[model samples]
Target: MGAVTRLFELAAGADRLGLAVTRIGLVVVLVWIGGLKVYHYEADGIAPFVANSPVMSFFYADPANYKAHMNPEGAVVPANRAWHEMNRTYPFALGLGSVIVLYGLLIALHPVLPQAATVGSFLVAVMSVVTLSFLVTTPECWVPDRGGPEHGFPLLSGAGRLVVKDAIMAGAALVTMADSAKAFLRRRARRTPAEVPSAGAVAA
Candidate 1:
């Protein structure tokens, strides 16, 4: 019985630690990717996804001309400059990067301002779902070649593989949101006299 009790306690401890680690992992990913979006190469790489997205296509000034400027090799060209300037790419990227960074910072502030963290987690969840949708909406997600490596349905191109990883982020965001929400509720409950059980109820 003692050994069993000890083992259960250890498992509980590990579960608590796992939640912290998950939050940290998500923060790292959001901050890193968000930071990269500020760069021209990363912004160019994502042009296809944004250009094809019905929800986001308006962000580009010339969505029709996106292909003419984007190089599959990720090279910077004269066309790239014109496309970026005309499309307002830099300002858009900077805005997105700022939002992402704020989310990470808010998550890290969980101990001090849990309400903010809860909001951040919710935002992360929403963003993750949008990103994962790219797998279906973006044609570049799957391998184009007929006989190429991992071609077709179950297989993804390099860009597709990257987008697919958003599934994990979505899951993580949900977990973080649940945790933060529970904490917030608990704190609220503590402050509410109505939530406290009477002595008779406790005895019962």
Candidate 2:
């Protein structure tokens, strides 16, 4: 095979590995965030996004809160309420986002689902891109330093891990996209008829 063709084949083979890796990551994230939501259900210090914007509230905010605040009970609130809601609902947002991420990964892993892996990689790519914004906006999310004066495992810390993790996923997504495109092109080329020159043209 040509070098380029071999590269495309390698890319095509990456789907299985990428899906497996991404599935594990998604599971870890979901379990972690789900645990967080279970522990931190209260909305204290949260920004009340569900209670403010009508359109934006449905995504990750509590549906009840969204319904409650969508109509408003009395006075008009400030415009920055959305930001506040974002802060207050941060844990919930993470929890819900993790669930969706996990679901996408699961779907990707299912062989019955055609193009599941490619679709999952695309979804993960979107999450990775969004993680960039989250990292920029909340550097504190990358908690550093380990063990302190007590435990001695020196476990890894910080949201910075996510930076590396997501970047890898994005690269995998690119590979999957390339592989899919090549496969599609190859299939189309096979279906197409080979062109034949006219007798007069061949004689020339």
Candidate 3:
């Protein structure tokens, strides 16, 4: 084959590997971030996002007290600790971590259990969309200080940058889902028999 033809062949052959790698990369991200959520600091950092979310705010025991315990100024007082405990942040984080870990594991098992992987991919896609929505729902996504150079509607804060990255994850999940679904259909096709030609037609 010509070099160009050989390159095209190689690219075609790499599709499965590329999908596998994408799945693995997503698994790593989910597990790593989910694991971090189990810690106090990580959970605390996400408090603003969760609190501002109408769908998720109910998870906290005292959503209104989120800022009180955050101690944004780095002052660790009794009130801070009390508010953190009262908010039930740890339990919520743990629950979210558990679900994310499960999703990662399911995606990792795609080779053996593609159906589960498809389900996991679907869940990841949903989660990604929800995370991306934080950019719109959370005021903290944009710089708060009008005096700062970066402060503006178009200028994203650190949290906004983090949320924006979820767009890639959402795209990845969609690709993985499509790949898994194709595999599922192919598997089903193999299990069913194709129709045989009639004897009269074969004679012709």
Candidate 4:
């Protein structure tokens, strides 16, 4: 084959490997972030998000009172700790982390359980949607209105930047889901007969 032809051939055939790498990236992100959710600091950091979420505010004991009892990362305040305990922040973080780890493991087992991996991929996409919604629901995502010209809808804060990354995660999950679904269909095709007897053939 010509050198150019060979290059094209290699690129064309690398789709599977590319997806495998994407799967690895997804697993690493899910597991690493999920594991972090178990820490007190991590739970405290998410307080603003959960407190502001329309769907998730119920997770806090008093979402309206969250700001007054906020704990800065790594800071130990007895009153804030007690409030968080009452709010179930630590317990919720642990549970969320466990689910994330489980999702990563499911994706990792694709070689043996593509079905589970497909489900996990779907969940990942759904979760990413929820994460992205924070940009709309959480005020912390936008620069605060501190009398600065750079504080408004188009101005994203650090939390906003982080939430925006979920769009990429959602896309990756969809690509993996599509690949898994194709594999499932191919397997099903193999299990069925190669051909069914036609009505004309039976009549003949």
Best by TM-score: 4
Q: Which pairs clash in model 3?
A: none
TM-score of each: 0.84, 0.41, 0.85, 0.88
Output the lDDT of residue 121, model 3: 92
Instruction: Estimate every model's Cα lDDT from 0 to 1.
Output: 0.84, 0.50, 0.85, 0.89
Worst 10 residues of 4 by lDDT: 179-188
RMSD per model, one decimal? 4.5, 11.5, 3.6, 2.7
Candidate 1's TM-score: 0.84
Return the TM-score for candidate 2, rounded to 2 decimals: 0.41
For model 1 the local lDDT of residue 204 reads 100
Question: Which ranges in model 1 have alpha carbons more than 4 Å from their true place?
Answer: 1-12, 72-74, 146-150, 193-204
| Local accuracy of candidate 1 as per-residue lDDT tens digits, 1-35 | 99999999999889889999999998888888889
Model 3 misses residue 90 by how many Å?
0.8
List, residue by residue over 49-119, the lDDT tens digit for candidate 3: 99999899999888876765785543556677677778888789899988998888878777777788889
Location of the lowest summed lDDT over 10 successive residues in candidate 2: 38-47
Q: In candidate 2, which residue pairs get closer than 3 Å at backbone N, Cα or C atoms, i.e. clash?
A: 46-88, 47-84, 47-85, 47-88, 48-85, 49-85, 142-159
| Candidate 2 structure lDDT | 0.50
Better of 2 and 3 by TM-score: 3
Question: Which residue ranges in model 2 land beyond 4 Å of their true spot?
Answer: 1-123, 144-157, 198-204
Residue 48, model 3: lDDT of: 88
Give the distance in Å from residue 15's predicted Cα in candidate 1 to where it truly belongs.
0.6
Cα lDDT tens digits for candidate 2, 1-204: 599999999999997787557555654654454445432332322223233334444555354443333313233444334533644455555565566556455434534433555565566567557654444443233454465553212222343454446666566565654454455566668979999999999999
Off by over 4 Å in 4: 1-13, 193-203
User: What ranking emerges by lDDT with the best candidate at the front?
Assistant: 4, 3, 1, 2
Q: Candidate 4 at 122: error in angstroms?
A: 0.8
Better of 1 and 3 by TM-score: 3
